[model samples]
Target: METLGEGDGPIDIHDYRHGLKLLKETRETSLWTNKKGYACPACGKPFEQLFTSEKQHNTFSPSSVTPFCIRREADRVLMFRH
Candidate 1:
Protein backbone atom coordinates (compact mmCIF):
# COMPACT_ATOMS: atom_id res chain seq x y z
CA MET A 1 0.00 0.00 0.00
CA GLU A 2 2.87 2.34 0.74
CA THR A 3 4.32 1.79 -2.72
CA LEU A 4 6.24 -1.37 -1.74
CA GLY A 5 9.88 -0.58 -1.31
CA GLU A 6 12.76 -0.66 1.13
CA GLY A 7 13.35 2.09 3.71
CA ASP A 8 9.63 2.80 3.76
CA GLY A 9 9.55 1.77 7.39
CA PRO A 10 6.37 0.20 8.79
CA ILE A 11 2.97 0.62 7.24
CA ASP A 12 -0.02 2.01 9.10
CA ILE A 13 -3.37 0.31 9.79
CA HIS A 14 -5.09 2.05 6.94
CA ASP A 15 -2.44 0.78 4.55
CA TYR A 16 -2.37 -2.67 6.09
CA ARG A 17 -6.13 -2.97 5.93
CA HIS A 18 -6.11 -1.71 2.37
CA GLY A 19 -3.53 -4.28 1.41
CA LEU A 20 -5.53 -7.07 3.02
CA LYS A 21 -8.67 -5.92 1.30
CA LEU A 22 -6.92 -5.95 -2.04
CA LEU A 23 -5.51 -9.37 -1.35
CA LYS A 24 -8.93 -10.76 -0.49
CA GLU A 25 -10.53 -9.11 -3.48
CA THR A 26 -7.91 -10.41 -5.87
CA ARG A 27 -7.53 -13.72 -4.05
CA GLU A 28 -3.81 -13.23 -4.12
CA THR A 29 -1.58 -15.89 -2.59
CA SER A 30 0.68 -13.46 -0.78
CA LEU A 31 1.13 -9.76 -0.11
CA TRP A 32 4.20 -8.72 -2.05
CA THR A 33 7.39 -10.45 -0.83
CA ASN A 34 9.09 -10.83 2.52
CA LYS A 35 12.09 -8.97 1.08
CA LYS A 36 11.35 -6.16 3.49
CA GLY A 37 9.45 -6.08 6.76
CA TYR A 38 6.32 -4.38 8.01
CA ALA A 39 4.80 -3.22 11.29
CA CYS A 40 1.39 -3.31 12.82
CA PRO A 41 -0.20 0.13 12.33
CA ALA A 42 -2.39 -0.04 15.43
CA CYS A 43 0.34 -1.25 17.82
CA GLY A 44 3.43 -0.07 15.91
CA LYS A 45 4.88 -3.54 16.44
CA PRO A 46 7.21 -4.88 13.80
CA PHE A 47 6.07 -7.99 11.96
CA GLU A 48 8.93 -10.30 12.71
CA GLN A 49 7.24 -13.49 11.68
CA LEU A 50 7.86 -14.03 7.97
CA PHE A 51 7.86 -16.81 5.44
CA THR A 52 11.37 -17.72 4.44
CA SER A 53 10.43 -18.66 0.91
CA GLU A 54 7.65 -18.64 -1.64
CA LYS A 55 7.23 -22.39 -1.17
CA GLN A 56 6.35 -21.78 2.45
CA HIS A 57 3.73 -19.27 1.36
CA ASN A 58 2.23 -21.71 -1.08
CA THR A 59 2.07 -24.44 1.54
CA PHE A 60 -0.47 -22.56 3.61
CA SER A 61 -4.13 -23.09 2.88
CA PRO A 62 -6.13 -20.02 1.96
CA SER A 63 -8.18 -20.16 5.16
CA SER A 64 -5.06 -20.15 7.34
CA VAL A 65 -2.97 -17.77 5.27
CA THR A 66 -2.04 -14.34 6.57
CA PRO A 67 0.18 -11.49 5.52
CA PHE A 68 3.77 -12.62 5.00
CA CYS A 69 5.29 -10.71 7.90
CA ILE A 70 2.29 -10.32 10.17
CA ARG A 71 1.71 -12.26 13.36
CA ARG A 72 -1.72 -13.18 14.54
CA GLU A 73 -2.59 -11.77 17.93
CA ALA A 74 -5.42 -11.65 20.43
CA ASP A 75 -6.16 -8.01 19.72
CA ARG A 76 -9.01 -7.54 17.28
CA VAL A 77 -7.32 -4.74 15.40
CA LEU A 78 -4.28 -6.90 14.70
CA MET A 79 -6.33 -9.67 13.22
CA PHE A 80 -6.73 -8.10 9.78
CA ARG A 81 -6.25 -11.34 7.87
CA HIS A 82 -9.48 -12.72 9.21
Candidate 2:
Protein backbone atom coordinates (compact mmCIF):
# COMPACT_ATOMS: atom_id res chain seq x y z
CA MET A 1 0.00 0.00 0.00
CA GLU A 2 1.11 3.57 -0.65
CA THR A 3 2.23 5.21 2.52
CA LEU A 4 0.99 8.78 2.77
CA GLY A 5 3.42 10.81 4.84
CA GLU A 6 5.95 13.64 4.80
CA GLY A 7 8.97 11.45 4.04
CA ASP A 8 7.47 10.09 0.82
CA GLY A 9 5.87 13.32 -0.39
CA PRO A 10 3.06 15.74 0.35
CA ILE A 11 -0.02 13.58 0.86
CA ASP A 12 -3.42 14.90 -0.01
CA ILE A 13 -6.79 13.61 1.19
CA HIS A 14 -7.72 12.83 -2.40
CA ASP A 15 -4.59 10.72 -2.72
CA TYR A 16 -5.53 8.74 0.33
CA ARG A 17 -9.05 8.15 -0.98
CA HIS A 18 -7.68 7.04 -4.32
CA GLY A 19 -5.34 4.61 -2.65
CA LEU A 20 -8.14 3.15 -0.56
CA LYS A 21 -10.32 2.76 -3.63
CA LEU A 22 -7.58 0.95 -5.42
CA LEU A 23 -6.99 -1.38 -2.51
CA LYS A 24 -10.66 -2.15 -2.17
CA GLU A 25 -10.96 -2.89 -5.85
CA THR A 26 -7.93 -5.13 -5.86
CA ARG A 27 -9.06 -7.25 -2.90
CA GLU A 28 -12.83 -7.04 -3.07
CA THR A 29 -13.27 -10.72 -3.82
CA SER A 30 -10.25 -12.13 -2.04
CA LEU A 31 -10.87 -13.59 1.42
CA TRP A 32 -8.38 -11.31 3.12
CA THR A 33 -10.64 -10.60 6.08
CA ASN A 34 -13.74 -12.01 7.71
CA LYS A 35 -16.30 -9.33 7.09
CA LYS A 36 -20.04 -9.83 6.75
CA GLY A 37 -20.89 -11.79 3.61
CA TYR A 38 -17.24 -12.87 3.48
CA ALA A 39 -16.81 -16.63 3.46
CA CYS A 40 -13.73 -17.78 5.29
CA PRO A 41 -11.70 -20.47 3.62
CA ALA A 42 -9.86 -21.50 6.77
CA CYS A 43 -13.09 -22.11 8.60
CA GLY A 44 -16.51 -22.54 7.09
CA LYS A 45 -18.30 -19.68 8.74
CA PRO A 46 -19.76 -16.24 8.11
CA PHE A 47 -18.78 -13.02 9.86
CA GLU A 48 -20.61 -10.43 11.86
CA GLN A 49 -20.02 -6.71 11.56
CA LEU A 50 -18.61 -4.75 14.44
CA PHE A 51 -17.56 -1.19 15.16
CA THR A 52 -14.51 0.20 16.92
CA SER A 53 -13.13 3.67 17.33
CA GLU A 54 -9.74 4.95 16.31
CA LYS A 55 -8.08 7.65 18.39
CA GLN A 56 -8.17 10.83 16.34
CA HIS A 57 -8.49 13.32 19.13
CA ASN A 58 -7.60 16.90 18.18
CA THR A 59 -8.20 20.34 19.56
CA PHE A 60 -11.28 20.76 17.38
CA SER A 61 -12.40 17.18 16.84
CA PRO A 62 -13.04 13.92 18.63
CA SER A 63 -12.73 10.28 17.68
CA SER A 64 -15.55 8.28 16.16
CA VAL A 65 -16.34 4.61 15.81
CA THR A 66 -15.17 2.89 12.66
CA PRO A 67 -17.37 0.07 11.43
CA PHE A 68 -15.70 -3.26 10.78
CA CYS A 69 -16.41 -6.96 10.63
CA ILE A 70 -15.25 -10.02 12.53
CA ARG A 71 -15.78 -13.75 12.70
CA ARG A 72 -15.87 -15.44 16.06
CA GLU A 73 -14.51 -18.95 15.98
CA ALA A 74 -13.90 -21.47 18.74
CA ASP A 75 -10.33 -20.33 19.07
CA ARG A 76 -10.34 -16.71 17.95
CA VAL A 77 -12.25 -13.80 16.61
CA LEU A 78 -10.85 -13.11 13.16
CA MET A 79 -10.77 -9.37 12.70
CA PHE A 80 -11.14 -8.01 9.26
CA ARG A 81 -8.52 -5.47 8.16
CA HIS A 82 -10.21 -4.15 5.08
Candidate 3:
Protein backbone atom coordinates (compact mmCIF):
# COMPACT_ATOMS: atom_id res chain seq x y z
CA MET A 1 0.00 0.00 0.00
CA GLU A 2 1.01 3.57 -0.58
CA THR A 3 1.28 6.15 2.20
CA LEU A 4 -1.33 8.86 1.92
CA GLY A 5 -1.00 12.44 3.23
CA GLU A 6 -1.92 13.50 6.78
CA GLY A 7 -4.55 16.04 5.61
CA ASP A 8 -7.15 16.03 2.86
CA GLY A 9 -4.69 17.47 0.38
CA PRO A 10 -0.91 17.78 0.41
CA ILE A 11 -1.17 21.53 0.21
CA ASP A 12 -4.53 21.84 1.91
CA ILE A 13 -3.50 23.79 4.98
CA HIS A 14 -6.79 25.69 5.01
CA ASP A 15 -10.37 25.35 3.82
CA TYR A 16 -12.07 28.21 2.04
CA ARG A 17 -15.41 27.53 3.78
CA HIS A 18 -14.45 25.95 7.12
CA GLY A 19 -11.19 27.88 7.55
CA LEU A 20 -7.78 26.55 8.72
CA LYS A 21 -6.88 23.81 11.14
CA LEU A 22 -3.18 24.67 11.75
CA LEU A 23 -3.97 28.30 12.48
CA LYS A 24 -5.59 29.73 15.61
CA GLU A 25 -9.13 31.13 15.65
CA THR A 26 -8.12 34.28 17.57
CA ARG A 27 -4.87 34.77 15.64
CA GLU A 28 -5.36 37.12 12.71
CA THR A 29 -3.42 36.83 9.47
CA SER A 30 -3.03 34.27 6.73
CA LEU A 31 0.41 32.76 6.35
CA TRP A 32 1.78 29.43 5.15
CA THR A 33 5.32 28.24 5.71
CA ASN A 34 7.22 24.99 5.32
CA LYS A 35 10.65 24.57 6.83
CA LYS A 36 11.39 21.57 4.62
CA GLY A 37 10.07 23.54 1.68
CA TYR A 38 8.36 22.47 -1.58
CA ALA A 39 9.88 22.41 -5.02
CA CYS A 40 8.37 24.87 -7.46
CA PRO A 41 7.28 23.26 -10.72
CA ALA A 42 8.32 26.36 -12.66
CA CYS A 43 11.55 27.39 -10.94
CA GLY A 44 12.66 24.01 -9.62
CA LYS A 45 13.49 25.74 -6.32
CA PRO A 46 11.89 25.43 -2.92
CA PHE A 47 9.09 27.88 -2.13
CA GLU A 48 6.43 28.66 0.47
CA GLN A 49 2.96 30.24 0.34
CA LEU A 50 2.01 33.17 2.54
CA PHE A 51 -1.51 34.55 2.68
CA THR A 52 -1.82 38.29 3.32
CA SER A 53 -3.85 39.14 6.43
CA GLU A 54 -4.06 42.02 8.91
CA LYS A 55 -1.03 40.63 10.75
CA GLN A 56 1.82 38.25 9.93
CA HIS A 57 2.13 35.27 12.29
CA ASN A 58 1.37 31.79 10.93
CA THR A 59 3.11 28.64 9.79
CA PHE A 60 2.63 24.98 8.86
CA SER A 61 4.50 21.95 7.60
CA PRO A 62 4.27 20.12 4.30
CA SER A 63 6.25 17.06 5.32
CA SER A 64 3.42 14.50 5.01
CA VAL A 65 0.79 16.84 3.65
CA THR A 66 -0.63 16.56 0.12
CA PRO A 67 0.79 18.63 -2.72
CA PHE A 68 -1.57 20.99 -4.54
CA CYS A 69 -1.70 24.40 -6.15
CA ILE A 70 -4.64 26.80 -6.12
CA ARG A 71 -5.02 29.81 -8.39
CA ARG A 72 -7.95 32.19 -8.25
CA GLU A 73 -8.87 34.54 -11.06
CA ALA A 74 -11.65 37.01 -11.69
CA ASP A 75 -13.62 34.36 -13.54
CA ARG A 76 -12.78 31.07 -11.77
CA VAL A 77 -10.35 29.06 -9.66
CA LEU A 78 -7.83 26.47 -10.77
CA MET A 79 -6.23 23.65 -8.79
CA PHE A 80 -3.58 21.14 -9.79
CA ARG A 81 -1.36 18.56 -8.10
CA HIS A 82 0.43 15.26 -8.77
lDDT of 2 at 40: 25
Candidate 1 residue-wise lDDT, 1-82, digit = tens: 1232223344333443433322222232334322234444434444433222223233457765655334332221123221
| Candidate 3 local lDDT, 40-82, one digit each (tens) | 3333444444333333232335752456554333333322232
Displacement of residue 79 (Cα, Å) in model 2 is 1.8
**Candidate 2 Cα errors over 4 Å, as ranges:** 1-64
Please, what are the lDDT tens digits per residue for candidate 2 over residues 18-67?
Answer: 32232221211212322224332233334332112232321212232333
lDDT of 2 at 29: 24
Better candidate number, 1 or 2, judged by TM-score: 1
Whose TM-score is greatest here?
3
For all candidates in order, the CA lDDT equals 0.34, 0.29, 0.35
Off by over 4 Å in 1: 1-30, 48-82
Candidate 3: residue 26 lDDT (0-100):
32
Candidate 1 lDDT for residue 1: 19
Residue 6 miss distance in model 3 (angstroms)? 15
List all candidate RMSDs to the true structure. Answer: 10.8, 14.5, 11.0
Kindly report which residue pairs in candidate 3 clash with one another: 10-65, 10-66, 10-67, 11-66
Per-residue lDDT for 8 in model 1? Answer: 39
